[model samples]
Target: MSFALSTTVDLDFDRTVAALREALSTQGFGILTEVDLSGTLKTKLDVDVPRQLLLGACNPAYAYRALQAEERVGLLLPCSLTVRAGADGRTLVDAMDPALMVELTGTSALTEVAAEVRSALRAALDALETR
Candidate 1:
């Protein structure tokens, strides 16, 4: 089974990023970190590249519950939301399917949390589409 879902949209990179942040907010997820790979690579290694952004997203409640189940679960605390520009000049939004993600760990406590996360993520994706 796929752990993530992705969709390509016609918006430019910057707009897409904004839409993603909005979508995340609507789903009760806060973006804990944002990484601009293109800029980082260029500034750190002098390698110019296309647009690529990584967002570390988390729902604090779910994270805390998951951690209570397993402290080491922090390894996967924040889910990744990646946005990238294709060569065709289209933007793509990708996020993990928390249902599938939790399954990988085989933790019973994560099942209920995964359902909540899946709902939030689905809302996020719908929000992106409407934007």
Candidate 2:
């Protein structure tokens, strides 16, 4: 199974990131953390890129349920959404497939939560694609 779903968007990188954030929220997800890979790389390694953003998204209810099912699930707490610029000047938005992580963890309790997260992420990805 694919670990992530991705699509190249015609929008600019920054707009893509913003649209993804809005979509995720509309699907009941919140951005718990955001990392600017471009900025971090520039600062840490003096490397520069056009744009690269990482968003850690989470639905609180699902998170709570997952935690109840597996205490170590925190290792994969928030699903990640990435926005990066392509060589063609378009932006790409990618989201981690919760089902993949759930399978990796090997927990039956996470089955429902994984389904919900996958659906929510799919909705968010669809919205991003439209924008």
Candidate 3:
């Protein structure tokens, strides 16, 4: 199974990142954290790589539901998505598949919550494509 739902945007890295943030917000996901992956690597290791950013997106309603179902699930509370400049001259956006939570936790209680989060993520991706 694909671990992520991804798309290639015709826009440049900066534009794609902005568009993705707006799309995610439209789907009720607030970015809780932002990590400059490539910048960090370059600063620490002196390695050059494609521009990349990691966003920790979260929908409070789904997060609350998931936690109610399983306390330990907090470890995976925020959904992670990556935006990067692809070698092909376009920007790539990849979002984690929420269904994995159900499979990993082995908790039937999280099934509905996972599906809901997955749907929102799908909507965000769909919006990016159709926009």
Q: Write the per-residue lDDT of candidate 2 for residues 1-131, one digit (tens) a residue.
A: 88898888898887887888898889888999999889999999998887888899989998998899899999997888888899998988888888876788999888998898888888888887776
TM-scores, in order shown? 0.88, 0.94, 0.96
Cα lDDT tens digits for candidate 1, 59-110: 8988898887767778776988889998898888888877764676777778
Residue clash pairs of candidate 2: none
lDDT of 3 by residue, 1-131 (tens): 77898888888899888889899999889999999999999999999999999999999999999999989898887999999999998888999998888888898999998988888998887777765
Query: What lDDT score belongs to each candidate, Candidate 1 first?
Result: 0.83, 0.87, 0.90
Best by TM-score: 3
Residue 58's C-alpha lDDT in candidate 3? 94
RMSD of 3: 0.9
Clash counts for all predictions: 0, 0, 0
Better of 1 and 2 by lDDT: 2
- The CA lDDT at 66 in model 2 is 89
